[model samples]
Target: MAFTGFGGSTSGTTDFTQELVSATGLAERDRPADLRVWPNPTPDGTFTIDAGEARILGLEVLDASGRLVRSLGALSAAPFTMELGGLGAGSYTVRLLTDRGPAVARLLRQ
Candidate 1:
């Protein structure tokens, strides 16, 4: 699937409901790859993002209120480590942009 870009409501805040999509002819449910976040429920706020065979292009971490808290602009690696030590303990959403498509995973900081 080819990820065109971010799209959502016109209210202002970005809605990440449309996780992945196909720009060509593939179906919407056809995901090119799987995005994995390990060490979930992290105690130290450190975790890893693994995109399987897909290469990670960008990464974003959003708070529970849908506010962007952390972002790693453009990247070219996978299975990398990230630390959220500065952020308060709470639930966050992790969004990773990959060559195949966009992958999202829930993260818990403690």
Candidate 2:
């Protein structure tokens, strides 16, 4: 398990399984290069996703237990704001299904 935050590039194809494993890790170290989340530990459960150069095929939000909490489906926009105001405060995982592969990011709702 590996983890990373900020500073990565979506320059090549990535293995979905590996990306998922890296993203799900507890520490921040080895996530995909192209994915980024801002206003993390979001105050109102709202945040932005910026996938540089990578085409996003799908996006989903999962609870800490790894259960699907919200599915945004296929998105045409690259940089977009996601609203999680409906859910309670805690930890969440964001999975991005992209042309390169799947990227995962941990989120905290405050």
Clashes of each: 0, 6
Candidate 1 lDDT tens digits, 34-102 = 888879899999998888887778889999999999999766666789999789999999998877888
Off by over 4 Å in 1: 1-30
The C-alpha TM-scores of every prediction are: 0.70, 0.69
**Residue range 9-104, candidate 2, lDDT tens digits:** 488644433235634553443345388998988999989998887778889999999999998877788698999968999999999988667899
lDDT of each: 0.83, 0.81
Instruction: For candidate 1, report its TM-score.
Output: 0.70
What are the RMSD figures for all models against the true structure?
A: 14.6, 15.6
User: Which 10 consecutive positions of candidate 2 have the poorest summed lDDT?
Assistant: 14-23
Least accurate 10 contiguous residues by lDDT in model 1:
15-24
lDDT of 1 at 67: 99
Backbone clashes in model 1, listed as residue pairs? none
